[model samples]
Target: MKMKKILWFSILSLLLVIATGCEKEKRAKTKEEQIFPHNLEFAVFELTTHQACKVACGENGEILISLQDVKDDVDTNCSLAQFDSIQMMEQIKIYAYLNINGDSTRLEVPSKPCGTVSYYCKDKSEEVQDVFRLIDEIRDAPAAQGDSAWFFDTFERLFGKGASIDHTPYRIYLAKADPTKFDAPHARLEDYRLIFILTTK
Candidate 1:
């Protein structure tokens, strides 16, 4: 009788361990499903300086950009213009996150600047001229009500009307931290640390 009772206890302990492990595995799978519902193709994020000026201007801030659901053809070698393609633009979604002094905010579908691809031109003269044109255009535009408004509206003027592009198959996004979203005073773009999260199809 004693031997039988000991055997039964051992079996029960083993069964409990197996059940717990199975439950844990089930929960992990569920969490993964929740995070990603669709097939992911590619994802990349980068931290770079937001070049506010053409020269060695010290007025630059750290910014993050993410490319998601991008086509296989596009890679680090591809210029921003290549990413500006309409087809890829429609398929991809970009996001930027900002953290300042512990406060964080998400810039959903952040605004992009016009003539983004011009920076990648091999011809230095042409690149400089195109960049100047973009700067002038932004300066001439009507004053925006806020930082967010200005950022979005400036890009909207160029992209909203279906601006033509020679490149195809990708879209690029530029993100900036909104001052109103955080409590920081006199906060410049350099004051915030940006993070980007990308998911590919």
Candidate 2:
């Protein structure tokens, strides 16, 4: 009788191990299936608008998503504003401001070109910490020792400088560039995704 009991216990242990292995394999398969464009594997976050997001890309890229924006109830009241939520901010190319990280965390530095779009979170890592340090350096740096107006105009990009008037008689035009792109009268975060690509300099 004791022998039979021992045999039963061994069988149970083996079955438990097999089950655990299968579960792990299932998870591994799922991870493999989660493939993004350009063979990029990103760490995601739930971000917010007008909020500063500090992103870092190591061997494994990092990203912050404003899940809130996904469900944000946007309200806009403009004289002439009708922007296609599809082709604007969601999938625009970010060529110039690729390596900049500032005007978000520090109060001393004024935002240039464009303010950092960020959100709040509670995850910490060495890679992100390094980015913060770099931000400090950028903040302290002199303002290039010259007039910034001579440089390229971000006003056109951010505030829609030369907005095309649908009707010139009344100055009908699309909404100014802002974070409300994810809200209603534009696009919802549910159907579309605000993918912010992260790369290192």
Candidate 3:
């Protein structure tokens, strides 16, 4: 009877140690994610005009996607919101990151034009010009898990076929009502100099 009790105790202790180790690993990973979010090295940009967009992940200084509003077919009718429920594109662009899965938080005001920004460009197909208006200053932002497919999916749905969906995904988390704007969300065209900093404050 004493032997049986000792054996049971030993097994229980081993299980507790294993469980503790697993829990510790999870905490460490979560901390890492929170600390460093944006992957600047693999960052990509899409030049949007006439309500169209694209993604170019690997080609540095190359504008991968160029969306054009051909046929003038886009307006109130046959819009993105009309396709199933893809309301994320607008929110993502405005918010800097799409929250595919997160709690419903407060909605902030849409950013207005604050000031002008300049970009020194070289080694690209198109001329270098700052497309986005400066709303906030560029600073180091939190690491974000951006969805490359978020734009890719919408562009393909809007343009169809030849739409660009080829790029690496770096997740981003953005809010509607947040005060800080004009950073990543405000980035326009091919400005490799501008770096996105997701604000958590």
Candidate 4:
């Protein structure tokens, strides 16, 4: 009877070990499947206007705009103003403003010949943090530095840049550029993205 009991105990232990090993292997495979390189997809939506982009990409080789959403419900009696905007590529080249840490790039803006799209970074790792930092920077930076005058002018020509129209609120997005989709190892994603904003007069 004692010998029989010992044999049963050994078999149970072996069965338990085999079951545990199989579980671990399954988990490992799941992790491997989700390990998609740095590439990710994002979307941007404007709450007030109901305008949204399915996908936004980065210009040059630097950064891409992925997810942008605005949920502000504040009431404002503002009118839309027209703008005359130049092509983003014509006005500037795409460039990334990286944070102190190499792990993340905060924002991607066009490198204009005469203007600077200044940005601030709250946290160098997270995407939402970077967006808030960018807003803070825009609020603090000098108007001349980020003057989208040409863009406004072009918009005005197309839509009417006067002060009587209702001004539309806008939002921006950022995403990780996919090397596989672009197929350029060194491509500074300057074209496959949603660029800057064009507001009215």
On lDDT, the leading prediction is 1
The superposed Cα distance between candidate 2 and the true structure at residue 80, in angstroms, equals: 50
Q: Which 10 consecutive positions of candidate 3 have the poorest summed lDDT?
A: 130-139
Ranking according to lDDT, highest score first: 1, 4, 2, 3
Listed in order, each prediction's TM-score against the native is 0.26, 0.21, 0.25, 0.25
Task: Please give the distance, in angstroms, between residue 112's alpha carbon in candidate 3 and its true position after superposition.
Answer: 5.6
lDDT winner between candidates 1 and 3: 1
Residue 108 accuracy (lDDT) in model 1: 31
Can you write out model 2's per-residue Cα lDDT over 88-142, one digit (the tens) per residue?
A: 3333211111112322321111111222232222443333343333333333345
lDDT by residue (110-168, candidate 3, tens digit) is 21112112223353322221221111111121212233344333322322222112232
The lDDT, on a scale of 0 to 1, for candidate 2 is: 0.32
Stretches of candidate 3 off by over 4 Å are 27-35, 41-56, 59-113, 116-201
Clashes counted in candidate 4 amount to: 38
Q: Indicate the worst ten consecutive residues by lDDT in candidate 2.
A: 167-176
What overall lDDT goes with each candidate model?
A: 0.36, 0.32, 0.30, 0.33
